[model samples]
Target chain A: MDSLTDKIRTLCTGLLKDGKVDMIVGFKKGTIPMSSCPCVARTPEQAKELIWDSNCTLNLANYLTNRKEKIGVVAKGCDSRNIVNHIIENKVTRENLYIIGVPCDGMVDKRKIRALFNDDITLFSEENNKLFVETASEKKELDKQDFLKNNCTTCIHRNPVIYDELAADPVEEQKIENRFADVIKIENMSSDDKWNYFNDLIKDCIRCYACRNACPLCYCPTCFVDESNPQWVGKGQDINDVRTFHLLRAYHCAGRCTDCGACEEACPMDIHVRAFTRKLVKDSCEIFDWEPGLDPNKRPALDTFNPDDPDGFIK
Target chain B: MKVIKIDKQNWTGGIDKSRENYQIFGPVKDKEHFVFKKLNLKEYPDMENALSVLSPKSILFPQSEKILAASLDESQDDHHIMKRVATDYSPRAVIGIMPCDAKAVQLVKLNFDTDDYRDPYWCDAYEATTFVGLAVNKPSIYDFTLSMGSGPFAEEGLDVLLVDCKDHFLAKVLSEKGDAFLKASGFTSEADADKSAKLINEIKNQAEKAIDAEKVKTEKLKEKSLLELHGASFWEDLSFSCINCGTCTFVCPTCWCFDIQDETKGKKAVRFRNWDSCMSPLFTLHASSHNPRAEKVQRVRQRFMHKLKYFVDKYDQGTMCVGCGRCVVHCPVNIDIREICNTMNSYEAEQA
Candidate 1:
């Protein structure tokens, strides 16, 4: 972990100092445990602050939106995919971005770590693919694979789809047949059961829009929630409004979502927000046989619909 | 001060007693974290857990609350007109609210119950609930409430302060509202006032000592001038990772910014107020499409300045923040306010 961080900082410094990029975007050690913060460096001195680790879970592609400057960005597999999505959407130019990609080991879920201890985790350090946690008076070690974030464990893409520079050798992708097991559980339920299921899931959402704002693809000038001409939803905490917000927001990402878990990561409420988006990812694969951001030339599933598109659901 | 002792076994009975007269709210275990929710007859609040994901400010000011409702039918007499949503303003008690969150209610009150126009939704809710604060025996690492002018046991906005004593609760009743609550709960056991006071002091001193060890800068912020601090030029770097999300604002106890909208759901047209954050670009966008604080850096600076400087200067009181540490913990990017506050406080004006 330490060596990777050093390597990233060295690369970022060279990028900034050589004027190859106006800025370098990466992660730095966070004040809290088990996480890192996104950092942008315009100077070589600032570039030295960058680090890399399992905690670099936030997708850096969110920062590339509408960026005007030529810059370098540190990207993981999901982040690189979203960057391609941005390039295809004209939110940013391919030439302006210098993507330094890293093969990923899933991010550690700090919330789950806290749950394991059931107390304040005072000191936490990761080494040898295991977690060493210290509470007020006790310390324990746990296997890292057991604690990998739910999103990462199910991820099929552990290597970036595109990169200007590879920080390290690519990691072998996971082979999992049951990636959509949770989504299937909801799908198997009766129609009323599904409605009730989603309602209960999003009942606690405060409508703060963290899930919407954190996604790289949600770059609307005026969000539908904020529209006044014909308000599609109310600004109340009613279950109907909250449910509508989550459903509509997920529908917007039907074809473009990469299942990066950035939306779920940003949710303060720890809502299984992915439950809403993951269903869409499954349908896109089953129906359109299309995966997003694999090629720069290919558009998203919804962006260009074929005349031979299946009409199974329409009838 | 009225000091009362209640046996742990009878605590639920007392809470049940109050349920008949008032709607009872307390922190209940949600899936992974805790949230302030209305209690059932047998449900218990876990005061020993980490802070609620969202602050107890939601007790008085919900994320979205309907203020007015009316009919949209053209044949109706009062079409396109709004009327007050009849709310139950009956007395309620929120148990297990943290001391810092209680203080935050007091801080946010400056905006809602001011000398000018009053926000009736907030004011009515504030008036209806009695705040019961639980003392923090072990403060979280993110907590800097000591420097923020509120402490774990600080008694600013609370009616009663509770100390968890393993087998029982030591309740210090500060106001008549608290006394009335206790009486209604059928808690008649009174403790020796001096001895109870001495015990509370020992616990408070020990807790405060631990908090004082991790000093988070606050005092020097008041001494800095507005212009120099605003132009300090480090704000962009500080807010670099900000996704401009509403997590920080919605979880905040002191962030009271809200937007009012009217929506017609079926036949009912309702006006609702939902929490809004200054970090969002839409928060400042004008109808003319010209926004003064359009830039992310400017919006970010406004959030801190309003919490740490503008509110201080305008109210002639302290900073607007109660420092419950929700934003520091929940910000996806980990934008620590402690670092920002220290920078603003210590920034010096260039040689004139």
Candidate 2:
């Protein structure tokens, strides 16, 4: 990973020095351990601060929305897909973006790691497939596979679909048999149980909108929740308002979502926000035989019309 | 001040007894994190737990509250005229509140309860409740209370400071409210004052030492002009990762901003005060469809400037932060306040 970090820094530095882009957006080592925050480097010296680690969980495509500058962005598997979605949606032009792609393994879930200790995790480092965690009272070595984020564990895309440059050799993608098993479990529940399940899932929400803000798909200048004239959702934490916000936000991302897991990662309450979007992901796949962001020239399933499209659900 | 020795065996019974007189609110295990909620008959506060995910500020200022309400029907005498809504102001006690959170309540009081104006809702709730703070003997890595003018064991805004001494708790009664609550709980076992004070002093020093290295210099902030710090070049890079979400402000103990809205059902209309954040795009939006802090950078700058500069200059309080570290631990993009504070404190504007 250190070698990967050095390679990325060198690539970004050369790009900036040659005036290929105005800025390079990448991850920088955070003040706290196990945190890599998004950063924009405009100089060769600043580019040297870029890092590559499992802690880089946020989607970099979020910074590319309607950006005018010729920018070089570091993209992992999910980020590159979102960038394709952005290009197809006219959020960013392909000529302006220099995608430095990374073949991702997976990101570790901080919530899972924090749950293991009663006190704060003083030190966290990763090497190969092992995680070294230390606290004031205890030290433990754990398997990285056991601590991968839920979305990462089931991901089939380990290599970027589009990239101008490669950070490392491509890694083999996972072959999961039952990708939609969790969604199926919810689908099997009774209507009342489903209602109770979703209610309980989002009951802890504080309406911070972290999930919405973190997703690259949520690039509206004025989100529906913010519209005051004909407000679509209330501003309070009422259960009904929270449900409306989550369901409506999910519907908006019906076919465009790439299962980036940025929403779940950015949620402060650790809510499994993907539950809402995963259903849409499965629906888009089964009904339209579609997967989003695979081709930049192709329109999304929901945005286009076709004679063979499933219309049984319309009734 | 009197120190009461509460044995572990008597703790539960005492807490149960207190329920007869006051509604007990304390930290309980809520799924993944601890939260302050009303306790049932046998549910005691999780004293061994670390900080709650959200502060106990909700006890005084809820996330959503009804400040005023009105009806649209003409049959009512007060039809269109808004009136104060009814709220519960019963006697209650917040048990096991963090010392930093207790101090945060006092800092927020500067805004809600002032000489010129008093927020009726906040003042009423504050006057009706007592704050029983729990001492943090084992401070987390994120805790910087000592550096922010409060310490793990500091008892500035608490009625009583409860220190966990392994097998028993050393309850240091600080006010008349503390005494009355203890008496109501039937906890009259008083320990030797001099010896208990020495023991608490030792523990306080140890906890404070753990966070001593986190001290951020804010004296330089006082010397720099507000415009100079506001227009600092570091603001852009420092706020690049901000997603313009309210995660930081929502979890913060001292963030006390709210937005008012009215909801209508049939002929009834009720106004509500909902917790609002400076991170939101609409926070500074005017009725004329113009927003001053329209850009994400401006919104991000406002949060820090208000916390670190504006509040410091206006109220002369050290800063409007208790250093409870909730914002640090919960920020999705890892936007740390400690780093921002240090940057603002040490910033020297380039001479023109």
Candidate 3:
């Protein structure tokens, strides 16, 4: 059987050669270990640069927003869902995209792997379910499942919701118990405790806006924080300003987020940014019974208004 | 120069004792990663910390600072007039700061302490702080400090350099501030000067050897014309992965760009200087709604050009990077500055 990388390259090369897509969006080998940066491949030769691995953590759907060219995008389960959301939002047209869906084995958290050693991780590679980490002094072999990203641990969508082609057989989605345990723990706190908990969570945020930029849904021409005329949020490190930015950003993606984990992966501070969005995800699920991006034909929970919608908090 | 031997057992006590006259800051474990924090009496600096997520630049230049303030009231004297905010310029010591970060401070000084204009806030804060650098015995694979003209044992900007020797630290005083700090800590046990110097050199050689394996050409960057490099075709592909986030700039010790903003709340007004990144869309936006670098590629190009070309040409001091590898390690999309530097250095413009 051809590896996923080989299959994707072969498919993308055929697409580019046939002039099916003007470009192919995918992952390329990164400069350092446990990283695969996004790349744009316009030719057959460039398409060969595309690789599929556990380190392909970023959402490739982000590159598809408002693009003019016909694009063949390599998408994981999360990326495909985001593409559906993009189509629904009219950020991209369904006709312009050829999504090569990947049945993903969860991405490994680089931080977790890094924590296992005192020295730097010089090289990281995976085989089967095992990960090999090498440093100057020693080499360690560990289970990939043990180092999976937090979002990947509870992910129920291992197969893409929508795809033009499948790179491999669909992965078995794990049956997760108490998926919102962390959120429930926070919800059980008193209002003051919750306030303090959130404050402590974002204490290290430098207001770099990596979280906002990494998000596929945050394709606004001008972010609310950037508005100067009656500026919504102050451009300082003030606690209130920082809190406001996070709160408003989470609210913007309330019902539209697909739990892609791109924001947390992009953060340099290693802050648990998902702590803000996860609550909203739970609320959207519990109240509206809405899960975004499962179907391109369906409107977002926030976009459509129903007569029987919950209005208990209106007063 | 003086060399003092500080026993490992006395480290905490000496650090505590120095707090009487100095506000000490050092690297401490902050949740998952390490960060420089203001230390209380009980806390000790983690001298062996592998890396700090953010550099010690925030010590002298905070992420946000109030420079001026005023009253908007009509009846009061000195109303509607902005006055420089009073700042605490007391003595402080930054212990266990990496040599690259210390060099970064000096690189930033070129902008803050120029011949024509002097930024009082930066210069004042810089003067108040004492930099005590910790020599890197084991350089990370990402660290390319030696290629950028600063090394594991570089002492360009530090007042003192501390070498870890298992049982004790060998402190080599490089400036008067270091000597004063040692005296204040009551650490007067002088090591054999010649022996200590030889030991430090041995450690430095080993560390530099590990760093010397990596290559990043910057000497030829001087020969290349700015326009030729700026118009290079590689930037488009090079910048494709960039998300235009401020992670690289924010974590960088040498990046010193700032935006001045005024906020008015009720009858009180304040002017703040906040750290800004060229990667931001608004960084170059004009008041007339015109944007010079509107595209993401342009913003990405500007960051590299400024760091690798513009600053190098203007100062003739080298690239604006100290090669601390913070950007390399922290960039979400893995945009490596080392690769960019090499590309810019060796780039040749096609004939027109």
TM-score of chain B of each: 0.97, 0.98, 0.98
DockQ, prediction 3:
0.88
List the candidates ranked by TM-score, beginning with the highest.
2, 3, 1
- How would the candidate models be sorted by lDDT, starting from the highest? 3, 2, 1
By DockQ, the candidates rank as 3, 2, 1
Using TM-score as the measure, the top candidate is 2
Lowest summed lDDT window (length 10), candidate 2 chain A: A228-237
* Candidate 2 residue-wise lDDT, A1-315, digit = tens: 888899999999999999999999999997787888999999999999999988999999999876678999999999999999999998998999999999999999988998998879989888998999999999999999999999998888878999999999999999999999999999999999999999999999999999999999999888999998777788898999999999999999999999989999888888989999999999999998889988998999988999988788687
Per-residue accuracy of model 1 over B1-352 as CA lDDT, tens digit each: 7889989999988999988887898998888878988787788677783688898887788777888999988899998889998888899998998898899998888889978889888899999898888999878877888888899889999999998877888999988988888888988799889998998899888788768534577677777899988887788788778888888888898999888877765788888888888987778877887889888889889999998888878886777877788898899888888888878877888666
lDDT of 3 by residue, B1-352 (tens): 6899999999888888899989999999988999997887898889984678888999989899999999999888999899999998899999999999999999999999989999999999999999999999988888899889898899999999999988999999999999899888887899999999999899889888888535887889888998899899999999989999999999999999999989999999999999999999999988888999999989998999999889888998988999899999999999999999999988989777
**Error in Å for residue A283 of model 1:** 2.2
Q: What's candidate 1's i-RMS value? A: 1.2
Which of the two candidates, 1 or 3, achieves a greater lDDT against the reference?
A: 3
Quantify all predictions' global Cα lDDT against the true fold: 0.86, 0.91, 0.91
DockQ of each: 0.73, 0.86, 0.88
**At residue B267, what lDDT does model 3 achieve?**
96
Worst 10 residues of 1 chain B by lDDT: B212-221
Write the number of the candidate with greater TM-score, choosing between 1 and 2: 2
